[model samples]
Target chain A: QQQVKQSPQSLIVQKGGISIINCAYENTAFDYFPWYQQFPGKGPALLIAIRPDVSEKKEGRFTISFNKSAKQFSLHIMDSQPGDSATYFCAASSEAAGNKLTFGGGTRVLVKP
Target chain B: DTEVTQTPKHLVMGMTNKKSLKCEQHMGHRAMYWYKQKAKKPPELMFVYSYEKLSINESVPSRFSPECPNSSLLNLHLHALQPEDSALYLCASSQDHWTYSGNTIYFGEGSWLTVV
Candidate 1:
């Protein structure tokens, strides 16, 4: 069974606009949520991560909003730029599971300047 | 270097041939991982090594073998791979694999492999 589900296989946004991506998980055992960014022919890099205790976390232009009760989370990019275009993946992990992460399919974002 | 390095950025091998993909990290991380990703899909974990010991094997096929010769190095040996096995191989490392909180992982540029 797929542990994490992400919506909008692809997205497009104009410069300075906000780009949003949403994800949901069925495994309540997951307590850690992280987002990763990857470019063409490159490996994924962690962008920002949040624990289940927090409702939201933000770093620079990236923000992650999480709802514990709903077992869902979303990523929001403010003032999106052209360079922010890439594939974004939402992943989850738990200490009980040896920190093995289960990832979402992915969302390709295109920012137009 | 502070980043993970993977050798042979691209490789193409025959079905009967044998090849190895190498990865190295100098970040003093004791936990290393091997992940495979296909086009338009997320990475799938294949193996995990903690403190130079094999910790997790995600039911990977017998044709794929992973080794951690040392804390700073990890290798994947491929034999008789099928065309469906062609994908991007990614290597990652983090601090000791004990704590999940405050644990950050770093990934290499990844090696693209094509099995003919």
Candidate 2:
């Protein structure tokens, strides 16, 4: 069973536009949510993350909005640039699960200048 | 180096051959992990080690074996593998195995393995 589901397998956006990706999780026990960005031929790097206690967390151009009751979360990149194009993955894990993350299918984003 | 390093960026072997993938980290993290990822798909957890001991195995097949000789090194031994096992193998490490609030995991570039 896919515990975490992500939508929009791929996306294209114009420079300076807002890029959005959505994800949902079925496991209510998951208390930690993190987003990772991966470039070609490289490992994934942690982006912004948010917990269920917070509704939103933003770091520079990246923003993660989470809904605890809905069990849904979304990532929004404002003023997207060409260099921001990469694969994004949403992951979740609980403290009791030894921090073993369950990841989403991932979304590839392309930004055009 | 504050990074997870994996050796042998790529490898190709026959079904009967035995090969091993190596990973190292020097960040003093106590938790290590192995994950396999297919093209355009999310990574699947294979193994986890904490404090130089095997913690989670994910019920992986017997053909794929993972070993953590020490706290800083992790090895995955492949023997009698099938074509379906060809994929990108990633290694990751974090500060602790039970904390999720402030733990941030770092991953290696990954080793691409292909079985002929």
Candidate 3:
């Protein structure tokens, strides 16, 4: 199946806390996984990405943890702030599909101050 | 610049009206895409163009026509669209679709289309 399933349709966290969003893909061919952040009335922007070869990739407060064997990946936001409140989407792409990204259901995060 | 610019940020057109959404990028990208997004939903792929040629259509309806006039320009012509078709239309571009390293697609602000 060419599908990506995401969990926690929505999340609520406090400032300085960590926000986590999980996703699982059924396609084994997917080699590129990326996370996108989108605000209201704006297009989704590329936040972070990882290849299956690495187990973890971190950039500042944004980190991506990948589990190749389980076909699962997650995004963690450390020291979450109110500005981090937005919709996050997990997407997977494969060379076979011309690198077309298959996005999962978005997770709406609300970081309370 | 790493930006994809779209025109007519907001549009309100009747079902019988004909309008087009334009997108441009000077990032020297060769792969462009058109995606449709409904409220609270992920963007759905509508079409893909590579090297100024149409590559994928995703079985999109004919009323939604996509054109890639050049390597830096893409357009979506809309006609006879229903009210349910009202949503955000996003334009994205990548360096190339054949290579994985250059597949980081960047999206434009998107055009908010309203069908009346």
Off by over 4 Å in 1: none
lDDT of 2 by residue, B12-95 (tens): 999999999999999999999999989888888899998889889999999999999989999999999999999999999999
Q: Count the backbone clashes (under 3 Å) in each candidate.
A: 0, 0, 0
Of the two candidates 1 and 3, the one with more favorable DockQ, higher being better, is 3
How much does each candidate deviate at the interface, measured as C-alpha RMSD after superposition?
1.5, 1.5, 1.6
The Cα error of candidate 3 at residue B93, in Å, is 0.3
Write the residue-wise lDDT of candidate 1 on A1-113 in tens digits.
99899988999999999999999999998988999999998999999999989999999999999999999999999999999999999999888876688999999999999
Write out the backbone clash pairs for model 1.
none
- In candidate 3, the second chain superimposes onto the true chain B with a TM-score of 0.96
Q: What are the DockQ scores of the candidates, in order? A: 0.68, 0.72, 0.69
Candidate 2 clashing pairs, residues 3+ apart or interchain: none
Those runs of model 2 whose alpha carbons end farther than 4 Å from true positions after fitting are B100-102
lDDT of 3 by residue, B48-91 (tens): 99999999989998999999999999999999999999999999
TM-score for chain B of each model, two decimals: 0.95, 0.95, 0.96
User: Candidate 3: which stretches are off by over 4 Å?
Assistant: none
lDDT of 3 by residue, A1-113 (tens): 54999989999999999999999999899999999999998999999999999999999999999999999999999999999999999999987887699999999999999
TM-score of chain B of 1: 0.95
Q: Write the per-residue lDDT of candidate 1 for residues B37-95, one digit (tens) a residue.
A: 99999999999999899899999999999999999999999999999999999999989
